[model samples]
Target: MAFRGSLFKFLVVITLYDAFLTVNSQAETTDPTKMTAAILVRVDQSGKGDYTKIQDAIDAVPSNNTELVFVLIKPGIYKEKVTVPADKPFITVSGTKVAETIITWNDSENIFECATFTVLASDFVARYLTIQNTYGNGAQAVALRVSGDRAAFIGCRIISYQDTLLDDTGRHYYSNCYIEGATDFICGNAASVFEKCHLHSVSEGAGAITAQRRESPAEDTGFTFLGCTITGVKTAVLGRPWGPYSRVVFAFSYISSAILPQGWDDWGDSSKQSTVYYGQYKCYGRGAITSKRVGWARSLTSQEASPFLTKDFIGAKDWIRPAPTSFRTASKPISHHSDGNN
Candidate 1:
């Protein structure tokens, strides 16, 4: 009996040692260029990963996936028209940094066809990347067009000249992002919150920051700017009514001198002046002049401005909870530029 026990113990020890060796080998042999994550696809321009193109990595994911599929993109300028299809949900595309990992194309005025990067999938999250339209200051070019629900863009730089960002539909969140354009740079009917972001106007002449298209007051579509900075070269207005009931609010934000004294426009429609809801609550800086603001524009009181200052406006708790909060409340109107990255 003692001899039999000794033999069994020796075999168990040998088995464990072999298993350790196998696991170690697998770890050591993992591709150095590949990033470790819940990554379903790895993209490397150097041809060391699963795919070389961002679109290929996106296509590799199965359709209608409920679980999040991460696409680890290496640092490089991917010059392709990348689109995240509507069928693919819970997709995350991430890179090392916004300046390092760029997805670019030059398409203009054709909406989706001209967009450099378009996301039609819901529950989409993108971080540490730059999306640009290189066509540069001619026609209506869109750098990034997002028509996805529960979509979040963090630490992203979207650069273009005209019609820069189409926040087309659904509820979206943009935090610590840099968006630049000349005309109607941020237009669409989406209920989006620009939190701690920098909005730049590159138009040599006058331009408009936003052109919200809310057809009805019942529709939950508007642009809310909280603790953000609006800086650019041209003299600009806050927004124009793309639709009759268009709504936009800039609360606790820094509006540079570039902003026109009129603050808001009626898009050349005199009747729209009575229907649009354009308001500013406790905003600051040289261009945040309220007394000279357009007669149609409103300076919201505390009670009227409360709802537009929180994540609950987008009902973010239902989908992506804990949207980035603002240190600058309506009462203080301070500039909170730091969202996370320092």
Candidate 2:
């Protein structure tokens, strides 16, 4: 009986130990810290980072990547055109400073091919970078083309002449960024929210700020600017219809004197004036005066403006997040220019 009792005690201890091991294994597997640790790579123009070119660092990330890969670009003007392919998701290409880190190109030929920086991957983020197409004042040159879904831009400066930001096809969010262009600058079919951003028009004549391309009422796509500031070198209209059923909204924003009194345009097609949905709600400034605005535009009521005023317009809360604070170095640090200087 004493021997049987001792064996029973030993078996209980073994069972508890096994259960403890299983629990610990499950805990480790489900740890958020381990799951969210980003893979870090650096890019420097002066050969001081993991890769000399921005594209090379991007290429190093494996296709269909599930982990967050942070591509830290050192300050300098990268003249090469860069594209983040669709397969490489969960990538953050960030610069230390906005003014010092520039990705520039001088392609003026085709609107489809001339973007300086293009994001084709979903779950992509670009922060504190100046993306510019140096084609001034004539052609359809695009500075930054974001065709990826769930992409976010924070504190970025996008510059060009026409079609500066092809906010293309995506559900996107732009926060505290500066977008500058002349004609039909911020145009596309994306459902996007620009919050606290500065839309500066460098138009010499009457240019349009946005050219939304929502073709049908069923399509959930439009451009909403909330708490944004609009300024320009010369007179510009708020937006025009790039598609028959285009939609755009500006709410609680500052519209500078650079805006035309006749707020919206129909893009030379009078028929578009009947179908496009352009509205402004509780906006202030000399440009926000709606008394002289086009008959088609609406002075939206509070209830009507409610939809465009929140991050829910782009459904950003589901995917939008800052780059992870913890990261594992993906490559050896090479000698690179650390000072963020132009």
Candidate 3:
């Protein structure tokens, strides 16, 4: 009996040692590259680039994964029709910077069916590129037609005569993006949060934003502008109701002088104003100081802004999406400054 007891103890010890070894082996063998969020694919104007055009590379990727595919395009003018399908989730199209990488094409209001870039995926990210439609803005020139959930645009520029950035579907986020247009140019049907982005008005007459055909107010199909800058000559307002139950909010924004005192235009339809939800929270600059804002416009208190302004509101739920293989650039260490802007 004593010998049997000793043998049992020996087996238990060996099992524990084997378990530890397996775990250590798995951990040690795991590749950091496989865990990368975005795989950088390059695009050059020269035919000698990795991918000749943008859409071809997007097609080459597999749809089974949500791992971000980062197209680190070199400086070039890529004029092509880009459509990001709904199946391709968590794809990131990046360029050097907005000033350098240019993606321009001409599609106008007359061409209602055509959109410069129609995004129909989730977590689609674009950074440091110019998306423009050179159709001269007569009727239906839509530079970017976004219809994705959790889409984020960082330090990008979108330009069109009208309908520059179309928020067609789902919850989206924009940070430091520049969208310029005229006459409902920024209108769309999506719940989007624009942060530190520029909303520029480029034309005269009936210059309004948002024609939101929200399915329901409870679904959050509206625009939330946070700490954005509004510039240009045409008088701007928060937005007009594109459909019944339209909603918009501007929090901590900087408005230019072009804004009207009444804030929003009736769009020749006073009836629609009854359903719209327009609000502003602590705006600065000339267009701000909303003493003359319309009665329909509401001012959000600090409490109301808390949830929307939180980190989770802007895709902080998970900063990184996982992929089988990827490259991760570590966050740079910041030098301590007294100003606390960092």
Best by TM-score: 2
TM-score of each: 0.82, 0.87, 0.79
TM-score winner between 2 and 3, please give it: 2
lDDT by candidate, in order shown? 0.80, 0.86, 0.70
What are the per-residue Cα lDDT tens digits for candidate 1 across 294-339?
8999999999999999978888766663222222111111112222
Residues 33-118 of candidate 2: C-alpha lDDT, one tens digit per residue? 23456777888777667888998778666565666778999999888999999987778999999999999998886777889999
Candidate with better lDDT, 1 vs 3 = 1
User: Predictions ranked by TM-score, top down?
Assistant: 2, 1, 3
Candidate 2 clashes: the total is 2
Q: On residues 5-98, what C-alpha lDDT tens digit does candidate 3 reach at each position?
A: 6775565445433322222233224332244545555666675555678886676554533344676788888889898888776578888767
Supply every candidate's count of residue pairs whose N, Cα or C atoms clash at under 3 angstroms. 0, 2, 9
Candidate 3 segments whose C-alpha is farther than 4 A from its true place: 1-37, 109-112, 311-342
Evaluated at residue 256, the lDDT of candidate 3 is: 84
RMSD of each: 14.5, 12.3, 14.6
In model 1, the Cα lDDT at residue 90 comes to 66
Give the CA lDDT, 0 to 100, for residue 29 in model 2: 38
